[model samples]
Target: MQPYRPSPSPARRTVLRGSLAASAAVSLGARPAPAQARSGRPRAAWGVQTGDVTSSSGLVWVRSDRPARMVVETSATESFRRPRRWEGPLLGPDTDCTGTTALRGLPPGTQIHYRVTLADPDDPRRTGEPVYGTFRTAPARRRDGVRFLWSGDIAGQGWGINPDIGGFRAYEEMRRLDPDFFLCSGDTVYADGPLLPSVTLPDGRVWRNLMTEEKAKVAETLDEYRGVFRYNLLDHNVRAFNAQVPSIVQWDDHEVRNNWYPGQILDDPRYGEKDVDVLAARAGRAFGEYFPVRAPSAGRIHRVVRHGPLLDVFVLDMRTYRNANSPGRQADDTTGILGTEQLAWLKRELARSRAVWKVLAADMPLGLVVPDGAVDFEAVAQGDPGVPLGRELQIAELLRFIKHRRITGTLWLTADVHYTSAQHYLPERAAFQDFAPFWEFVSGPLAAGGFPANALDGTFGPERVFVRAPQRANVSPMESPQYFGEVDIDGDSGELTVRLRAEGGTVLFSQVLRPGRVGQ
Candidate 1:
């Protein structure tokens, strides 16, 4: 249970004036609220997180509230002195009390400092009261350059957490861009978007919503998808951006409902579980027992997350191998969306990558066209302008095997069509061009509700150049502004630079590239 390496907002005001930083989007503090135990301990109140990491290993989530025992320690300083304990796992309820701990060796790009506490599984001297966090550990040196922050939809459609604007505040604006990790890039949760403790807004405002009872609906049980992953840890900017970022999480199809595939069958009556593979196997075992990954299988997510010699990050779980939603002009499909053994394990991990930025990440949005309704097709360009049909013939066989294996620095980050973009693709503006010319980009929802900006499907000819969306559709997040995506790289100019920010981090659009380039 503890083997495999491992690895791995609240607010106030405003003050964003241009080109990136000057700070002041307010409230990046507040983390109290689990006191009053005095002695009988066993707490952890939803905080400590870290994931995937690599280089020397990582991982360390926590969740307790009872039956405790997780212990974790680690330290590179935060005054933890000679630390490095680890032990974790036992907070039961069959994974509801959540757990995850792996640590191992460590010391790659430095700065670790963990914590966690929680004992009392029968009184090992009653513990609890630790919780701190910190990350960073991938660089083995390419001159140590790489940064992160990709986004995802969280608490969607009915948009939860709104402590008068101090909640899920775009995860404290991508945790003040401290990024060493965080890719999420999917609908982390929206398990069919529920919530509602107030709404009204068509302009009259109102919004509100902090709801819980499994977010007031839709998540069909496995403890209602572990209470929608403990409802974004009741946000303090998503637990202070999971205590200083370190994540690689993946999953699309709203984490379990909208646009769900893999033998889908629910005609949606708000589900009594008309089997969308039994509500995606209880929302993928409550999203792998609340996200520190490993031990997943139902609706299995894809893998690869290297991060060292300058990024690898493949991630993609395009909904557990697919081929459902229709109208994608099936001209003899072969499980189109990454299905045949995850397309031969992503063409054998992009032909044994040696890292220099591969990052396919993607959870939808190949060329956008998203529809799933008026005729099926829920992603991977089904608005076909001809040629490659059905999930663009498995992304045209992984872009003709990365252009006949000349693979170099791939790229293609994504987030389900919720705004922010940058396409590019070409082979002379394709309709099925055999490949070489990349860059996909696309940002996200971070704190849900923002739509508008979908159609582009020229069977991968792409070329959007840069978008910013929201002219309507769901909107609200105090009326639009919450997208992410930022890259960086550049260790003596291996140059990657992406940007596309917003919601106080601003930058709105940027591009860069260069590094054994294919399309610039």
Candidate 2:
């Protein structure tokens, strides 16, 4: 992945008072310190994580204290010793001060412990706090079955009381099940619009001022996005859980600006030149800084990751490269949905895929039908289906691609809709059978704030199965404010079980989505 090289904009120091104040105040045992909270070196942090148990490789990342070379270590245990190792230099700010090291020649499915050490130019004792973490590789390519988790939209406001509303509980419950790795469907952080003025909590006093409403109505900006991300990452449980497993992420509306269509800069009347561009760039920069992704391809938001033969995950960028949002636009069927090039790429990958299962991950629902019995592409944008023919052609191309490919073992995961539910759709074959069989698991709001209901039955047409959790299932007992999804594949039996769990440790729903096995 190449580093970003945009012209430097004025760096905005994020206001830590509302989001990071408590942590800083407790750490310093004082009211507050200006940007320089501590007197020494900057504290270490990590973000945007993913990994695979390659036949002979593994990867790791951490934020740098300065532009210096980093040493990456892997061991069978936390105690570093005669285990395998790799080292690399994080060239410059292009990396946004984050370092990625790919270590090679490791055993498969090995629970190798790892950490990064910062080396200084002059100091003899240049090092970091071991930065302890762990990851395992994929099973042999021919391995029969494998399991992983997937979910999205985990966040609350930067200053809200119940920050855990965005699936913080889901993170804790997921730790107990401990799947191979997790999939962040989309909307990992709602950077919303620009950074607004955070209500100052000076002297721990909550003000009931009318100005708060005035600030709320203002447009979104870069600072707001950064503050939201900073606030979310501050959660200790989220950080700890991520340290143990690799998480693959793709962004949705909230990451940039809400309900944003390509070229539509949120509420900007000036279009391209508005604050939307600035905010988008900032959110992307922050996402790069905090997440472990292989950079966006050609300004198009899409990429594919292979987890050996067990699964092939396609992460798509639905926001970028989208046609402008409006009514009566021209229909260039060749360029919508996945765009001609990206759609072609996706089709080629699907045809060539030898993995047991293929997971298509998008930020929004693919087959979502609205109240009027029509696919509402512009529900967020109101009645204007903008360039209706173009959008429909895009949908047609995708449907044709899926049907022609006979792509079984393909499951869909999405976020941005704060709910936990799923439905199976099959557009191929003469008759439209309810059990035609392809599942879509939707999870969001790590700390859910919106109302959730039976979205499964509501979205995917009238007839859909709503499975109940089995009695005596060995599930967690804690109450979860956030929601998430999980899938477990038993290689020996070829059984892939998927489930949605609430923060309260209760299994909201579960289904054994058995691929390769039909009927009794």
Candidate 3:
């Protein structure tokens, strides 16, 4: 079959055209397979997932092999003899046969067992196999404790699904820890990464990737972008992990392409088209369709997830609102990393939050310098050592606002550097002393190529307390180390502990912090 070619015209860049909508409508009324004696088997292609858990509500997601109606039966008991059934949206070709159901009015701080059933659209009696998953609702008040894991950069740099050893082993280890939820910081899929069938390792061993057509090249069309997401589900470990643990997901540059910004023209010769906005639109739509997340206002993915009085996670959308990567830095520069509106929203949320610990779940680090190319950079810091410039100015202002507002017990967690490390930022060492001292933990490459740490931008005065990574770049998972970080907030003492663990679940570094003691 010939690859689908999308028109690169500016007029057609706003929306995805062609057979997408028509096929979606036709799929809605499509007939299901004929019922057989054993038709009750579950057919969840991507397994079951529950996310965005609140005091009274949560989101459940599943995908079917064909057009079907998603039905979720929930109960407090594992047996689920008298479970309550909730109907989900239609699973059709429009959303690539994926659907998410909002499970609302759930009891706070209670474990809810759910079984997902995908019934044939034509014959409701003929259902696929049922998949079981579980999630705990957020507490209504301060409770015993809260534990969650966080990481990013999955299936990137030729590190694709390996059928021999399940998928990403880190996920298996994380599931063993059994945290309340998983914060997928960013780089959920490398839309621009190409995966080959096989490659020769440095030790003469053959490393194989479970290949698919969409992952063969850079994602361009809607199908190719959807394929990128589907490729990750090929890993049984990932599917199993998603089923058990709820995921709070966000996106960085790799979902569309590395170091991409809105309105930027593609200069890479590998892509036949030049406009990046069209590709981003397709990628964003696919991301929304696949993940079990609430639609954000104005299409921005940045939002807050409050877990009672113990914790409040602020998931930042660093990719959506940003300025073009350039060399210039001025105090009065209107262009920034968080943009104007997002920056303001963050401040308002921080001030209004009543949780004991305000965790800034950021996609990118505040101080690390991620250079896009020879003259451009991707994150807040632009490699300028001393003074705040350009994007750094925005970060400086936000940090200053946190200090001015007297927001205590705030921490930043990120995972784009592909390694694990604990960094301490002190006001005494910083050029700008208006901000309070805080710790930022970084870990990941959950199943991607591992690389050495990037240089720190001295604007924030980050001191590396601990660093664990290979000296070389793009090392395979078998040869290199992978890491994930976990946060434990104690209900009784109100103490927060951060742990950075390796692939085998070994705690490489740990730190304990208490409220009101920051910067002391």
Candidate 4:
């Protein structure tokens, strides 16, 4: 976790953006102005969302402007006729005024319409306007088709919420797709990437950022980390999108710092606190409070989200239990990117899964060369083209297990390189050829700065069939359209189609795979 001295490279720390536009004050909608939170009966302007959903249960989340009692009413229809009432937690500052309500006994494959009401903690009659939301439960039968979106790297590299171009435009675009759920691959918050008021772009356009005190610098304290999440929620498009799409959220290094790991002390002068473990702990707490995830334990971020008979998403926590960033040339390293325990858990879950498709929702790309500095590596792969080394050994082990065990219908989805690409890994072309052929889809930078593509490591024998990356390093969103990926599973045909999409509904790349099959 002790990353070396920072350099000006785009792969290291994200470069910032340009000046504030005159229309910077424009609101996205569900986010209220500062004054409204002060004088009103507890407001739910932050909006409502649900996540980790199953056929019979899910988690509902909301935030209040003040200390209030959370109340939820759910019905089959939006009309609220014969609704079931669920009394939730008492929102307070302990959790940054945010809390999640666990809803159970829901109808499978049904659309759930729910509204969140924030009642004053002391006054029974004083309440805020209800913030409504909806989500579809996982199907109980195979005949029900399923669809969902996956993307990450939100508000990173100094490109923050820009009200002028409509803050976080990608969320609005993704919300319209109406996916059953969104797998927020990782880097859900750029706590380390601070916002500047404005900077002049290369082409003379002034890119303005919606700034706050905590966003002005790196998030170090717990409140500052909470502000990082709160800052993103200020975008009206994000809030509006949350009201519709439930998300399966996870975290990456940017949630705490750039290319961070466990137990490393910081060498960077930008930070006053040198211990990274302390920083990661605070970041994890804020992440749990902000995101609607069904973590198995208090600090666990890895879990399998079962979506009935069609799919099961194995969300990985590459950041939490990872071995320190190294040169990645170790001969015998059992504790690599995913520590031994997580690897075991993943193997157990993959073996137990009976779904047609098992999506490995990894925070970082598997075969890409993500460097921690000039020497150390960040992700699963380094530039080595030889047999499995360091983290590659762990990945090789997992792949060999899949091939040997005859576990079918597994693919990888990730977003950290700030680009969209499709890669196919074949054992025939790999140094360690004990694995079956599989596909890995990458997409992201939801509302952040885009960067050039990273080089692939040959140990996995990955062929980049398709890629859409920025021409230069740290390209602002204005110069590049944001990206996301979608998956559609046909219940009748049992075929899964993956589409890499850009902002404004353009499908950049796509591929189709048959169920329980390989080498598509």
Using TM-score as the measure, the top candidate is 4
* Model 1 per-residue lDDT tens digits across residues 1-520: 1111111111101111110111112122222223343346766666767888888998888877656789988887766889979788887777777789887789899877677788887767778557677788988999878888788988788888888888887776676666788889878888788888999888797988877777778888787777777777767667666777789898888778898888878877877878788788888888988888765644467889798987799898877778788888877778877788888988899899888879899888788788877888777787768788777887888888898888888988988877888988887888788888888998888788888888887876888888998888988788888888888888877888888888875687788888886555
> Total clashing residue pairs per candidate?
9, 32, 4, 7
Worst 10 residues of 3 by lDDT: 11-20
Q: Higher-TM-score candidate among 2 and 4?
A: 4
2 or 4: which has the higher lDDT? 4
TM-score of each: 0.36, 0.75, 0.91, 0.92
C-alpha lDDT score of every prediction, in listed order? 0.77, 0.54, 0.81, 0.85
- Predicted candidate 1, C-alpha RMSD: 19.9
Which pairs of residues have clashing backbones in candidate 4? 2-264, 18-198, 18-199, 19-198, 19-199, 20-208, 28-236
Best by lDDT: 4
Candidate 2 runs further than 4 Å off: 1-42, 45-56, 65-68, 91-96, 122-124, 141-144, 157-167, 193-227, 266-275, 296-301, 326-332, 369-392, 428-437, 452-462, 467-480, 517-520
Cα RMSDs of all predictions?
A: 19.9, 10.0, 10.0, 8.3
Local lDDT at 379 for model 4: 94
**RMSD of candidate 4 to true structure, Å:** 8.3
Choose 1 or 4, whichever is better by lDDT.
Answer: 4
Comparing 1 and 3 on lDDT, the stronger one: 3
